[model samples]
Target: MAELLSNSFPATPTGTRFWAVDKILLTYLAFTTILILGWWSRVEDAGMLFAAHVVGVALVVFEVKRPNRTTWIFRNWYALPFVASCYKEMALLIPAVRQTDADQWLADLDFRLWSVHPTVWLERVQTPALTEFLQIVYTLFVPAVLLIPLLIWRKRRPEEFQYYAFLIALGYLASYVGYLIVPARGPRFLLRNLQHVPLQGMWLFQIMQSTLDRLESAHYDCFPSGHTELTIIAWWASRAISKRLFRVYFTYTPLIIFATVYLRYHYTVDVMAGILLAAILIWSAPALYRKLSREA
Candidate 1:
C-alpha cells in the first residue's frame, strides 16, 4: 500500500531536488526575493525580512531531508500557513504599491450590473439572526480548506489529496498575486457611507468578530475574494470525495458567496472574480500538477 501510494505520488528524491510544494515555495521565494532586493534600501526591518527568507529556506531543507513526513505535513498543515505568511510578508514588504482604494470601480461595476451596491443594499435586510448565520457560514472557510484534504488523506487517497492540496495552494497563489496587483480594501473599510452594522450572534459569532478585528490588516486581500475561491475549491474537492459532503458544501456555498458581500468583506466584482479564478484553476490544476510533479 505504501509503495502503491509512493508510486502514485512520487516521493521527493534524495538530495536537492524539487517537489510540487518546493516549486510553489520557490516561486514565492523568488518573487519575494526580487521584491526585497529591488526595495532593499527602502525596506524597513531588514533583519526580519532576511529572517523570514532564512526560515523559508530552512523549511525547504527540512522537507527535502524528510520527504514522507514532510509530504504529510505539507498536505495536512503547512500549505495554508505558507500561503498566509508569504501573503502577509508581501503586503508588508511593498505597502505603498496601491495608494488609493479601488472601491469606486467595483462599486460602479456593481451598480452598472445590478443598479445597487450589493453591500449597501444587503444592509437593508440585515437582521441579527441572518448576520449570525452568515458569520457562522463565513467561519467555515478556514475549516473547509483544512478538513477536505484531511478527509482525502484519511481515505488513503494520496493522489486525490495531492491534487486537492495543489488546487488549494493554487487558489491562494492566484488570489495572492491578485492582491499584489490590485490592492483594494473592501466595502467595510473603504466605503464609509455604507451603513455598517456590527455582527451579532452567539459565541461563534463573537469569536469570528474578534478574530476579524484582530487580523484586519489583511484588508488588501479583497479583490478575487480568497474566501469565495477557497470555499469553491473545498466544495469541488468534496464533490470528488463523497456525495454527502458535496451536497452539504453545495448547499451552503450560496450563503458563503452572499456572505462575502453581505458581510461587507468583498464587492460583487470581487466575488465574481473569485468564482472565475476558481474555474480557471480547477480546469488547469490537474495538468499543472502533472507538469510540476515530473522528475527533473
Candidate 2:
C-alpha cells in the first residue's frame, strides 16, 4: 500500500528543477508585483511586504535544494504565512478599490431566506453547553486543514496529499477574492441595533474570545467565512482519503456551519456563500491540479 501510494504521485525531478516551486514563484511574483505597482502608495508597511516576498523567494530556493522537504513545507507551513500576508496586504488595498460594506444587503438576503438573522435567532436558545461545543468544533478548523494532509503524507499518499493541499489553497484564494469584492465586518459589527448576546461558556470560550479580540482589526475577512469554506474543504479532502476520516469530519460539519453564524463571526449569507465556494472548488480542483501538474 505504501509503495502504491508513493508511486501514485511521482516525485519531481531532483536538482535545479522544482515541480510546485514554479507555480508558487509565479503566484508570489504576480501578487507582489501588483502590490508594488498598483498599490504602492497605499501600502502601510512596505518593509513587511518586501520581507514577505523575500521569505517566499527564500522558501522556494530552499524547496528546490531540498526537494524531499517540499511536501511538508510548501504544502503546509510556507503557504500559511504567505497566504496570510497576502490577506493583510489585500486588506490594505481594499479601501483604495472600494469604500463600501455589503452587510445590509447580506442581512436582508438572510432575512428573506430565513425570516430572521440566523445568529440572532440561534442566540434565543443558546445554552452554555451548546456554546462550548460549538466553540470547540469551530477551533477544529486549524487542525482539519493541517492534520488530514499530514495523514496522507504519513501514509505516503503524496498525490492525495497534494490534491488536498491544492483544494485548500484554491478555496482560500477564491474566498480571499470574495473578501476584496464584498468587504464586510459581519453581523457582529454591522447589526449594532440588535441585542448582542455575548458568547458564554467555559475556558474554551475565554480562549476563543481572547483570540478574536487580538484579531479584531481583521474585520474585512468576514464576507464568505474562511472558517466555513476551509472546514468544508477539509472534510471533502478527508472523504477522498478514507471513509472513517470522512465520517469523523462529517459529524462536525453542521456544528461548524452553525458556529460560524451562532458566534456572529459570519452572517448567515456568508456561511451559504462558503458552502457554495466549497462545492465549486471540490468540483474544479482536480482539473485545475491536473493542468498545473502537466505544466510543471
Candidate 3:
C-alpha cells in the first residue's frame, strides 16, 4: 500500500470519473446533510445551511456527472470548500447529537496522565519568543497540509493525489466524528483559570490569536486534535511525495503537535489521541483506499 502511494506509481489522467476522494467528500456531506435535517430545529439558520448542503451535493453530483464541464481547478480543489462546510455543518450538528461538551472529562484524563495539567506545567518554559514561534508553527498546519497534495497534483500524479486526498478526508472526517463522540472545548477554554501564565507572543500575537479564535471559534472541536492528526498525516504522507517536502514536515510536524498543548488549544490526551489516530489512519487507510478505489 505504501509503495503503491509512492511516486513510483503515477495515475494517468483517466477520463473524468468520480474517484475515491470524491466519494469521501460526498459521503461526509451527505452524512452531515442527513444529520442537519434531523436536527435542523437546533441549529441557527439551519434551513439556510441545509440549502447550502443541497447546493454542495448538487455541485459534487454535477461535477461527477459532467466531467466535460470541469477541470482540475474545480475537480481537484472542490473538496476544500466542502471540507470547510463539513466543519461548519458538523459544528452545528454535533450539539444536537450530544448535549454536553466533554471538556471536564478530557481534562481529567490529562490530569491523570501527570497529576498536573500538561499545559500548566508547560507554562514554566513559555516565553514570548517561544510563544510567537509556536503560534506561527501552529498556524502553518493548514498550509503545510495543503503543500504535499499541491506538490503531488503539480507533479501530475492523479492516482497518488486521489489516494492522498482520500486519506486526508478520512483523517479529517474521523476527527469530526471524534468530536461528536467526545466533544471538548480544549485546554485553553476548559483550563483557562488553571493556566497562570499568559501566552504572550512577541509581535502580532494578539492579532493573530484573535483572528484564529474568530475563524475557529466553532463549538467543541478539541478531542483527538485535528491539527495534530492532520499535520502528522500530512508530514508522514509527504515522505512518499518529495524529499524536501518530507524533510520540512519532519521538523514542522512535531512542533505543531507541541504547540497544540503549549498554546493551550488541546489537552495532552488530545495530542496523544491525535498521534494515535494518525498512526491508525496511516496504517489502515491504504487498504481502505485501495478497496474503495477499485470499487469506485
Candidate 4:
C-alpha cells in the first residue's frame, strides 16, 4: 500500500524535499515580488505589469535549468518592505496628482531641485516628430536593459548574474526615488501653459491624458520622471554588458533621453534631474553592492 501510494505520487528526487529554495529561485522570487508589488502599487500604471511579464518569463527559464524552493521562501521576507513601498508609492501618486501639483509640492518643501540647463535651453522641445521619436526611444530602454541579462544567461554567465540583477534592481529603485522627489507636470502641460504652444502630437497628447487620468483616477503623482531615470540607467548599464555594443547605443542614448521632453511627456527639468539621479545610482551602486555582498 505504501509502495502504491509512493508510486501514485510523482517521485521526488531521492533525498530532496518536494520543494527547496535555491539561489536562482530566490532571485526569481525576488524579481516576481518586486514586479508585482511595483505594479500593484500603481506607481506607473502598466509599467510594472509589463516588467513582471518580461522578467517573470526569464525567471521561469532560470528555474527550469536549476530548481530551488528554499531560497525563494527564505528571501521572501527581505522583499516585503520593497513590495509595500511600491504599493505605498502608487497610493500616494494617485491622490498626490489630484490633491496638488507634485512640482509645487516639492517647491513648497524647499528642495529647490534643478534640471540640467540644456533641456530648458532648447527652443523646439515640443515638436510632433520629436515628441513621437522621444516616446519611442524612451520605450526602448526596457528591451535594451533586459537584453543584457538574457544574453548573459544564454551564454551561461552565472558569475555575472548578480551584477546584472543588482543593476536592474538599483535602476528601478532610483526611478522610485525620482518619482517621489520631483512629481511635476510633464512637458505637454508645461508647454501648453508656459510656452502657449498648441499640442500637436496626438500620441503624446493621448499618453499625457492617460497619465493624468491615472493620477487623477486615483490621486496626483508626477514629479521626478521615471521615463528619464530608468532610460538613462538602462543605457548606462548596457555598457557593463558589452562595450562594443554600448558604444553604438551610447551615442543615441542622449537623443532618446532628450525625446522625453520634445514629446512633452516630461519636463526638461525632469529629464535633467533624472539624468543626475541615474548617474548617482550607477556610480555608487557597484561599490555599495560589493560591500553589502561581503557583509552578507
Top-TM-score candidate index: 3
What residue pairs are clashing in model 2? none
For 185-274, candidate 4 gives per-residue lDDT tens digits of 544453344554554554665575465456434322345555566666666656756888688667767776666555445655566667
lDDT of 3 by residue, 164-232 (tens): 878888898899989989988888887889888888988977887898888876678888899999998
**How well does candidate 1 match the true structure in TM-score terms?**
0.86
lDDT tens per residue, model 1, 95-195: 64445557777777888999877777776788888888989888777887777876776677766776776688778888978887777777876666656
Off by over 4 Å in 1: 1-16, 41-44, 65-77, 196-207, 216-218
TM-score to true structure, per model? 0.86, 0.84, 0.91, 0.57
After superposition on all CA atoms, how large is the RMSD of candidate 3? 4.6
CA lDDT of each prediction against the hidden true structure = 0.75, 0.71, 0.81, 0.51
Residue 16, candidate 1: Cα error in Å is 6.1
What is every candidate's alpha-carbon RMSD to the true fold?
A: 4.1, 4.3, 4.6, 10.5
* Residue 290's lDDT in candidate 1: 87
> Model 1, 274: alpha-carbon shift in Å?
0.2
lDDT of 1 at 201: 69
Better candidate by lDDT, 2 or 4: 2
Candidate 2 vs. true structure, TM-score: 0.84
All candidates in order of TM-score, best leading: 3, 1, 2, 4
